[model samples]
Each structure stands twice: as structure tokens, then as C-alpha cells.
Target: MKKLLLAAALMLAAATARAEDNVVKVNAPPESAVAGETAPAKASTIDCADTLGVSRVAEVDTAGGGEYGEQYPPKPLLEKGEVVLTFDDGPHPEFTRQILDALAAQCTKATFFHVGRMLKEFPDVARQVQAEGHTVGTHTHTHRNLGGASMGQAEQQIESAINIAEATLPNGVAPFFRFPYLSDPQRVRDYLAKRNIAVFGIDVDSFDWRWRKPEKVMHNVLSGLDKTGRGIILFHDIHGSTAKAIPALLAELKARGYKVVHLVPKSRIETVAVAEPTAAPAPRRRARRHRRSKR
Candidate 1:
């Protein structure tokens, strides 16, 4: 009876361990005597079954009949110790500089989605980003509303920017492309898939669009970041306000106890545009909530 009980106990232990291994672990924010923070979450915070969509650590079935082949998706998050901060519409000389200074102080790496025109104008800042250990991606030749563009138009916008970025960047390599607006269609996804580029999308947006007021954007970001620590957090690095906001942003990020990680894809540079369609071009017009189908 004792031997039989021992065998059953071992079986239970094995099952529990397997269940634990399957859970997706999210990095918890650091705790401080500081006010307004969520304590670090445990592996138990993840509903392992549902988060396969966002798993960066596990071996995901890659494109083709192989494993995580030559081209794989960006690391979803650091293994319970990563935070990916992504900036878009940048290389704005003033703002990008401030943003970089912020990262430099923390030794944190981030992904910057560069606009082609902006990159042309501020090649120095773009170079600085790579030099400082941040990843660079294309945000399109013109920040066109992809939802309003055709297939050829979309391809041109993306490919042209990639060419320009390749020419300007080190080694003539431009790896990832993000749609100007986070617009996704099956056709668009299929087109990119053919090239083995993963669509980089934002999991959270700070809505810093509202003001030049650093405090407002900073407040919005810090509060939201407390909950969503591991995935991409979007902020614009174009405007004067965002530029001014970076120092505080980085400071708050540190105070909150996030490991500022420079997010670079292990395989290829993956660019994602976090966007919703603007249905109408007219002022005060709203895009009908009509489901826009994708290829």
C-alpha cells in the first residue's frame, strides 16, 4: 500500500510540474514604497491556454513545415524580466534625441518605427538609435493611411521605405516594416508573410496624442504600464511634447521597477503598426463600424 501511494504521489507531482511549465510568465513591475502600482504577478497570472497568441518564450510553430526557422517572430517579452518600449513617427531630431537620452540613462533598448521622410531629414538621429542599441523599423515612405490604400499602393509605400532605410542604415539592411496606421488585412498579412516578416503590433497605446503636457501622457502611460509590462507600449516621438516627456517617461519606468530592455528581434526586424481605420476622410466623419474584410 505504501509503495502504491508513493507511485500515485509521483504521478501527481509530474502532472503539476508539466502544468506549471506550460504557463506563460509575464514580468511583474517592481514594488516600491511608491504609490499606485500592481505587485509583481506570478506565473499564475497568465491563463496559459489563452496566451498562445502572445507567447514569446516558447517555440511557436513557424511558417513552413519547420520549427522556429530562419525567420521567427520578435521575442514577445523577456522571460519574466523584459519590457519592450516602442516609439513611432520618429527620428524627429529634437524629440528622438530626448527619447534616446532617456534610454541611455536607463541602459534600456527600445524599437523605433521611423518614417522615411523623417529618417532622410534626421539620418544622424536614426544612426544614433542603432548606435545606442535600439532597433529601427520602417513606418512607410509616407505615413499614409493604409486602410485607404490599394494593394500596389501598400506594397510601394512599404517597399520604398525599406529601400531607403536599407540605404541609410548600417550594412544596407532594413529588416521590418510597420504600417503607417495599424491596419491589417488578410491580404496585407499574406503579402508580408510571403517575405517572412512578422507584423509588429502594439499591445498598448498611451494616447499621448492628446497633449504636449508631459504629465498627462506620462500619467496615462505609467498607469497603463503597471498592468501591461511585457508587450509593446506605444508612444509617439515626433512632437515637442513627446520629446519633453521622455525623461519623465524613463524615470517613471525605472521608478516602477521595469527592466528597460532594448527590444531587438533575434531573427528578423519585425515592424507592426498599431492602428484602427479612419473610415471617412471628412472632418467629424466616423468610419462606419462596418466590418472591413481583408484578403
Candidate 2:
């Protein structure tokens, strides 16, 4: 009877240990969870050189060029079969790393327009972006729409963003700016122009901010690109949906024979012009606006 009870107890202990091991395996974070994927997807690789070619270009100088606010797309619009990948409002701890992993796997480079506060909060993530050979730009300090802010408020937003980005990024900040909500006032445009900074306007808006699902975000981006052929594609890395959609997006870009153009500012933009009080542009169609879902 003693031998029988001892054997049963040992068996029960072994089973309990196995159950605990199984629990740990299931509860631990996944290695393949990058890009917000809950499970590992089939691995694939892309050679950007063979799939999407890269090019170097100077910033578009829009000073008094009448292409100031909503009209600014990269001058000499990207040629057919070419696309510029840019992300705004990022350095998100979860999604940014996933996006970076996807970009790295594809061996592609992109520009990240980070909010100042986000950058400060995730300095290591910002450094990771730089370490991955991607360009870093500012999207204002708090992401407040500069169009409505007072000149003092607007200057503080832009200047503080630049200062924070420069302090955090080893490569310093790139000379490119994107208006939050695509709300660019002529006053802000002129300020950037005077400092020789380039203002970015999107040709293809991902609208990922609206659709949080990866499949839907992928479809929206591809459909937008289909209409425009090639230009700057706006995405926000802060969105987990965007990160989840990127691998599929890159795959589709390869399938469609689209090329990725990586834009690097000719040099770092460090100067800030004295704020000049000027009128903001009258409300025009918001260039960065995306379709709102009724549901």
C-alpha cells in the first residue's frame, strides 16, 4: 500500500509540473508577435533593390512658390512605379518596434515624423529608428494643429519638437516637417521655408488611423496608391494596425512592381527664423483628411 501511494503522488507531481510548463509557454510573449501579430505568419523576404529602387533628392523649396500649404507634394512627383514611405506621430513602444522589424526584414528605409513628447517619452525607440538607418523628422511638440494656435504657441510647438528630436536622435533631426492633421497655415509654411526646411504633404493617405484592422488598412493604402500611381504615402507608426499591415503592404508593393523611394534631407535643418505674424490659410479641404466611418 505504501509503494502504491508513493508512486501515485510522484505521478501527480509530474503532471502538475508539466501543466505549469505549458502555462508558461502559453502566457509568455511570442517571439513572432512583432507588428502586433498574435501568431507567427509565414516568413517571407524582400530585396528592396530588386523590388523597390531608392533615390536621393533635395527638399522641395516652396517659398513664394505658390505650392505652400496643401499643394506641396515632393517637387517632381515620384515617377511611376515609385513610392515614398513616411510615418508620422510615432516612437510607440509596441508598434514602432514591430514596424522597425518589418522594415528591417524587407531591407527598406523610411522616414519617421515623431511628436516631440512621444520622442522624449521613448528616447530608446527613437534611437532604434535612427540606428536602423531611417530618417527622423518632427511633427510638432504636442501634435497641436498649428493652424489654430497663436503664433507664439505655434513657434513653441515647432521649436520644442526640433529641440527634443535633436537632443534624442544621434543623427539629429531631418529638415522636413509635416503639419498635424495636414493643417498647414501659410504662417507656419513661411516659417519653415525661411529656415530652408521642407514641408511635407501627402499624396496617398493610408487612413490607417481610421481603420484599426490590418487587412482593411492594407486595402485602403493599396487602393489609394492605385489611384495616385506614386507619391509620398502617409502612415502613422503609432497605430498597431499600421504595424500589422506593413508586412502585407510590402508584399503587395512587390507583387504590384512598385518601388520605394527613401528621402533624405540634404542636411540637418537647425535654424529657426523669428516668428512673423501672418494670417493662416483660409479653411481649405484638409489635405491629410481621411474618410470617416459611419459605423
Give the best candidate by TM-score.
Answer: 2
Lowest lDDT sum, 10 consecutive residues, model 2, at: 32-41
- TM-score of each predicted structure versus truth: 0.65, 0.73
Q: Taking the tens digit of each residue's C-alpha lDDT, what string does model 2 give over 184-252?
A: 788888777776666777777777877789898888878988887877788899888899999889878
In Å, residue 171's CA in model 1 sits off its true spot by 3.9
lDDT per model, in order? 0.54, 0.65
Q: Model 1 — TM-score against the truth?
A: 0.65
lDDT of candidate 2? 0.65
Judged by lDDT, which candidate is best? Answer: 2
Encode model 1's per-residue lDDT on 19-119: one tens digit a residue. Answer: 33333322222331221111122322222221111112222211221111112354434544345577888788888877766554443456788877777
Instruction: Kindly report which residue pairs in candidate 1 clash with one another.
Output: 109-262, 182-275, 187-295, 200-271, 200-272, 279-287
